[model samples]
Target: MPRVVFLLVPRVHLLDVAGPAQVFSTADDLGHPYTLTYVAEEPEVATVQGLVLRTETAWPSLAPDDLIVVPGWRGPTRPASAGTLRRLRDHHASGGTVAGVCAGADALGRAGLLDGRRCTTHHTVQDELARLHPRAEVVKDALYVEDDRIVTSAGVAGGIDAALHLVAARHGPRAAGEAARAMLVHMHRDGTAEQVSPLLRWRSHVDETVHRLQDLIETRFAERLPLRLLAEATGCSERTVTRLFSRATGLTPLAYQTALRLERAGHLLERGATAETAARAVGFEDARALRRLRARPGRTMHSKEASWTQAHP
Candidate 1:
């Protein structure tokens, strides 16, 4: 089993810790032999979300294949004890992997792990990180980075993208895709991709109703889902459902469905499916309709084989 240890700081960002931890937990639920634990500088540290977290102050034994992560905290950087910093350095020096989310990278920097390593932090503090660690190569606008045994990510929900990338690198893209889909994440940001993917444009809502609608659209992209069916399923009037869907996803229900169909068709085409066959597979009326759909902006697709293990280096 691979062990993952998350080191916490005072007033830590809840999502920063929860996002990545949930990824491993989800993977473990799916039958991956993953062991997760939490350690902190204090026995009980307050979180930014108004909850106090009890943590193990003592260090845990870990094998070289195990992972250690530092999750970001709430305010300005507060220096941790030298003994704590030394543990981070010692773990990586012993061939274990270490990672950070957002300001957590500061902890790695203070531990001297960022020196000469490619890394990133939240966009708001990129300059500060660069100035503080002149020797570290601070990458900008990237969701995450990995150099040798060190991994780092941008802030907030960037933890999910970074964690998914780690899962992909270790298991396979299929496993990562399964985790994303299970968590209702619609897009998988690449390590070298911009912090935000265009596929996720205008998606900044947390309403369960809109989420349920999108989930249905994603699972049944190839079907003809009328607006009334969606509205009724969401238990709202058609006007209200349409307004909310547009507000939440920035696309009309039909537009969202079209995007989904085109996306699915792109996957089929990459797998050597003919245009007619792919169009039929994804609810397009014909090959001509699929061709016209593909003519839209950013509709070009790359055909990657189903074999996820060979997709990346």
Candidate 2:
């Protein structure tokens, strides 16, 4: 098994570590050969999340396939020792993968890995990174950037995307998708930036009854949804349930289910899955039906849910 070493710095953001850790861990659960370890400048490092992380100060022997991940910390700055910087640069030069999540890119820049390389950091720090490392090509607002052996990412949960992209690139898209599903994260497409698919987020409203109904449909959407059962779950008659659902979501129950299936089918198609397979997976009787639904006027984002990022926030 190839070993994955996490270089822990002071005042680390727990999720930056947790996100990629969880990604590779989940990939391991899928039976990938990966061994995770941690190294720190000290025996123990403090985290921004009010936790102390115990790590090995002694570096381990790593092969060409081995990896080192630098997770972002709370403060804009971290005290990376001379030894840490040497390991990062040396390992990458020798064919190992080195990656940074969010502001962890700063560490890579300091290690000279970002010099004349395409990279990115948290959006808040991209300009500073570019200014400090004049030779580094820092892509602003990128979900993540990969050049040669180095990978850098944007802020917060963008680490998840970066890690998953690494998994997809190294293993295969199917393996990465499985890992994502195991982690319960929406695996967004690579390149540019993406949030939780607006299709999924659009369903997030405060109507408990509608939420329950939608939740049920979400799980069994590929199967026939019994309107009576949904109505019963909503504590109302079928007609009343339809009215209530429309009032809450501005769509009939069937319309919402169709939308979910269509969106899912579109994603599958984007991933190179055949239309027939996508249709079957998303509950259409056949590819022809899915094709018709795709042709529906205003089938795509049109509701207040359209400007989802701004609409909700």
Cα-based lDDT at residue 12, candidate 1: 92
Candidate 1 C-alpha lDDT tens digits along 1-313: 9999999888899999999998888888877769999998789988899989899998889889899989998687584789989999999999999999999999999999999999998878899999999999999877899999799999688999899888888899888878888898766676654565435543568878888888887788777777789988988999998788777766676677666666667667754689999988887667887786577555523222111121111
User: Please, what are the lDDT tens digits per residue for candidate 2 over residues 1-313?
Assistant: 9888999998988999988899899999898878999999789988899999999999999898998999988765554988789999999999999999877888888899999899988867789889988999988667889999899888578888888888888899888899988988865556464334435645757778888888888887777776788987878899888777778878766767777777778778867899899988887656887786677664543334332221111
Alpha-carbon TM-score of each model against the true structure: 0.65, 0.65
State the lDDT at 252 in candidate 2. Answer: 67
Candidates' RMSD to native: 9.4, 7.8
Cα lDDT listed for each candidate: 0.81, 0.80
Q: Pick by lDDT: which candidate is best? A: 1
The worst-scoring run of ten residues by lDDT in candidate 1 lies at 304-313
Off by over 4 Å in 2: 194-313
Q: What value does the lDDT take at residue 281 in candidate 2?
A: 88
TM-score of 2: 0.65
